[model samples]
Target: MANISQLSEEERNDIVQRLKRIEGQARGVQKMVDEDRECGDILTQLASIRAAVNSLNGELLEAYLLRCIQNPDDFGSPEKAVQQAVRALVRS
Candidate 1:
């Protein structure tokens, strides 16, 4: 399928920035493991990373729904586009 959603440059940059921060967190977690840090501390950092990822997922979902609303023709009708958006959310 063709790309159905197109986000602005700022939105795309925000996502890239978030991914970079997550990457750094992952490396820090690895370092903590290598240094034999407290288990609780490592788990805390892992939880943070997971939460950040979930936040990004939410932003993408919102973007998809908005795109579906904007380009209902792509899905045949507005109602169908809504259905598609609902399905996307459910799958997510």
Candidate 2:
């Protein structure tokens, strides 16, 4: 597996917080299931979690592109780097 660069402290914290919130939401969903909560409400929360995760993924990808692929003044192989990034992003 390719090693990813470390995130900034702020970015790291933000990701942790988002993950925590998602975790909590999942737990709540479990509780809802146990208590037989409204299906619509549970589904709504699940959808929200999915959207949040997708948004977080987009943010991380954007940061990676900016820092790894675009900001390098001496990429040595700029075309290859950009193509790789584009391909990865498209696959994502």
Candidate 3:
């Protein structure tokens, strides 16, 4: 297994930017509600936001598996880590 690796500054910045965009989407949804937009339109926006959040979750999970669970030094029991990861993903 590969050793655990820390996220580079650029990677961290990219994640932050993605999160900010998601935040903007959430705020837009609120505005739509306040404006009494069509239910269909609001629902569409909500679906888009959900997709973005799921995408973000996938990215984070990939990073965790690659940088933490794959590293024996970082994760004492890789099998246990995998189980935990799977459980969390299932719950999500």
Candidate 4:
């Protein structure tokens, strides 16, 4: 399996912290399963984790767009970078 790497230190830390929190949530889910906790409770936790992940992805994409693709003052450069980013993101 290929190991995906983070591109920036700040982003890496943010993601790592989020993952650690998710790990804790997973552990909690396991305990909930072991103890036969309510299905609704488990589903709620799962949904929270999914939402957190999606929010992180959105944050990273917005940051990339604003910092990398939107900063160029020259005409067409920013748009080109945006298109490239969109293609790369779609491919991934």
Candidate 5:
């Protein structure tokens, strides 16, 4: 598998912030469970967290395609790299 290129400082910071927010959401879900909150409410929160994680994955995949797979200079076979990445993404 081709390695992902390094993210720019701004991109890294943004991803970190998004991850932190997700972490908070996870904690909130735990607290809700401990407090015996409604199952519906907890499931909703879990769905939202899953969506957030999927969004993050999409962003990272886009960055990887553009920075690593799409650059001929960076990867010897750009098309192959893209195909592999797309297959992996689909599998996930």
Candidate 6:
């Protein structure tokens, strides 16, 4: 949320649209489960969802780091920022 203020409306909308697609994919997975989808097919969709979430996390992390670097005073201590970023990257 830190660097979000620097984003243009178009950038924000792009992120929102990506999230919407992910939401749709999640719903599709739910429907597939309800229909008794093949295990492999369900697992494949789950993998895709994980990849999408990872991609979004990378994008947001890039934005956050850039903002913090461009405005360090607003980000608090450098150590805390590094800790937070690393924690996010290594999280399951």
Clash count per candidate = 0, 0, 0, 0, 0, 0
TM-score winner = 1
Runs in model 2 deviating more than 4 A are 1-5, 71-76
Q: TM-scores of all models?
A: 0.85, 0.77, 0.80, 0.64, 0.81, 0.82
Model 3: lowest-lDDT 10 consecutive positions: 1-10
Indicate the worst ten consecutive residues by lDDT in candidate 4.
Answer: 1-10
Could you arrange the candidates by TM-score from highest to lowest?
A: 1, 6, 5, 3, 2, 4
- Give the CA lDDT, 0 to 100, for residue 52 in model 5: 96
How do the candidates rank by lDDT, highest first? 1, 5, 6, 3, 2, 4
Q: Which tens-of-lDDT digit does each residue in 18-71 have in candidate 4?
A: 889888988888999999999999999999888877777777666655554545
Tens digits of per-residue lDDT for model 6, 4-88: 6578898899899989999999999999999999999999999999899989878887787676556655657776667666665
Cα lDDT for residue 29, candidate 3: 93
Two-way TM-score contest, 2 vs 5, winner: 5
Runs in model 3 deviating more than 4 A are 1-5
The residue-by-residue lDDT of candidate 5 on 1-92, one tens digit each, is 44433777888889989999999999999999999999999999999999999999889877766665556455557676667667767866
TM-score-best of 2 and 3: 3
- Model 5 clash pairs? none
Q: After aligning candidate 4 to the native by TM-score, how far in Å is the CA of 31 from where it should be?
A: 2.1
Report the lDDT of model 2 for residue 58. 90
Candidate 1 TM-score versus the reference: 0.85
Q: What would the per-residue lDDT of candidate 1 be over residues 1-92, giving only the tens digit for each residue?
A: 11523677888889999999999999999999999999999999999999999999898888888788888987888889989998989988
Candidate 5 to truth, TM: 0.81
